[model samples]
Target: MEHPLSQFKYCPKCGSKHFNINNEKSKQCADCGFVYYFNPSSATVALILNDKKELLVCRRAKDPAKGTLDLPGGFIDMNETGEEGVAREVLEETGLKVKEAIYQFTLPNIYVYSGFPVHTLDMFFLCQVEETSHISAMDDAADAFFIPLTEIRPEDFGLGSIRQGLVKFLSALK
Candidate 1:
């Protein structure tokens, strides 16, 4: 596995090669006294339970985890709250309008895109959709479907954080 900051070879502010790893979480430029701390991006995932007690899932359209089962959500947009982000992501990916979303839990995740592992703070929400009659896979999803809670398997979700999140969610219901 590659280091998260391995791609950063030069300091952005000073354009210097004197940039060195200051610590596990940061880098410092000896030439300019500039320090850069790696911070995790905030992401949201929605757990939408239908009237039949089925959970909505989508197949990822792109890599990182292409064609694998995933929850309906994505990276939160700038200036959007977690709830609002979840709502927007659900609408975009699953065509379901989220009427309400209850905060559930948060987990740290490493999302690798284009060979760079980007750390993320993933927030999971239990969501209620305004309507379930209309659902079409769009945006980042190739397909969308529902699985009964009893039939859900952790391994089905390709993302590590989503698998861990599903474990905790299932445990809480038991």
Candidate 2:
């Protein structure tokens, strides 16, 4: 795996070429004495189940995993809590207003964006929606729908963290 800061050739603080690896997770600028840390971005994943125990799923609309199965969630925006981020993401991607978002487990992920790996800590949540009948694929989701839990294959999920998280979730239900 490439270091998260491997692509950076100059110090962001000083724009100097003297930037060098300070440690496993940071870099230091020899010229300006500036230290930059690469921390995992906070992300969210929603686990929405309908009355029939069917899980809500979406299809990726863009690259990185275009057309592959995904959950409805995304990176937490500035100043947003995990719960708020999950609810907002669900609404944006599936048009479903989250009534509740219960905290669950978390998984570390490496999301490749713009040809660079973005390390992320994905916070999973069990979400309840106000309405399920009006779901429409929106935002980054190309398509969205509910699928029977028994019929879901974790391998079909495009993201590694999602696949791992799904396996853990299913195992917990057993």
Candidate 3:
């Protein structure tokens, strides 16, 4: 795979061709005196358990891992808090309104998008919903449903951070 900075050949500030690598994580433009840093994007992952203790899971509709299992969450939008992002993601993907979101933990991840590895800090949350019915897979989810915790397998999750989070979550249950 190419370096993340390989695609950026010009400086964004002045559109100059003198952009050069300043460090592993940043680029500097000799002509414009501008520096750009590559930072991980913030993302959220929800671990919603129903009263029956079944976990909510979604089938991915797009690549990076299409057809694999995933949690109901995505990249946080600009100016949105992590809690708000998780709630919005749950509602968007599963049509479930989150009543509350309790932050669990975070894991670094690499989400490859369009051939570029997008670094992300994935924040996990234990979310409670106002209701569990009326679920329909929308947005990027191909399908959404609840499975008993016993049925969950970490290997079933395609995203690395998600799989690690699942293991941590399940272990904590004991």
Q: Give the clash count for each candidate.
A: 0, 0, 0
Q: Sorted on lDDT, highest at the top, how do the candidates line up? A: 2, 3, 1
Cα lDDT tens digits, model 3, 49-122, are 99999999999999989999999999999999999999999999999999999999999999999988999999
Estimate the TM-score of every prediction: 0.95, 0.97, 0.98
Pick the winner on TM-score between candidates 1 and 3.
3
What's the TM for model 3? 0.98
**Per-residue lDDT for 37-113 in model 1, tens only?**
98999999999999999999999999889988999998998999999999999999989999999999999999998
Q: Write the per-residue lDDT of candidate 2 for residues 1-174, one digit (tens) a residue.
A: 878788999999989999999998899999999999999999999999999999999999997899999999999999999999999999999999999999989999999999999999999999999989999999999999999999999999999999999999999999
Write down the TM-score for model 1.
0.95
Can you list the residue pairs that collide in candidate 2? none
List CA RMSD, all candidates: 1.2, 0.8, 0.8
- Candidate 1: list runs displaced more than 4 Å: none
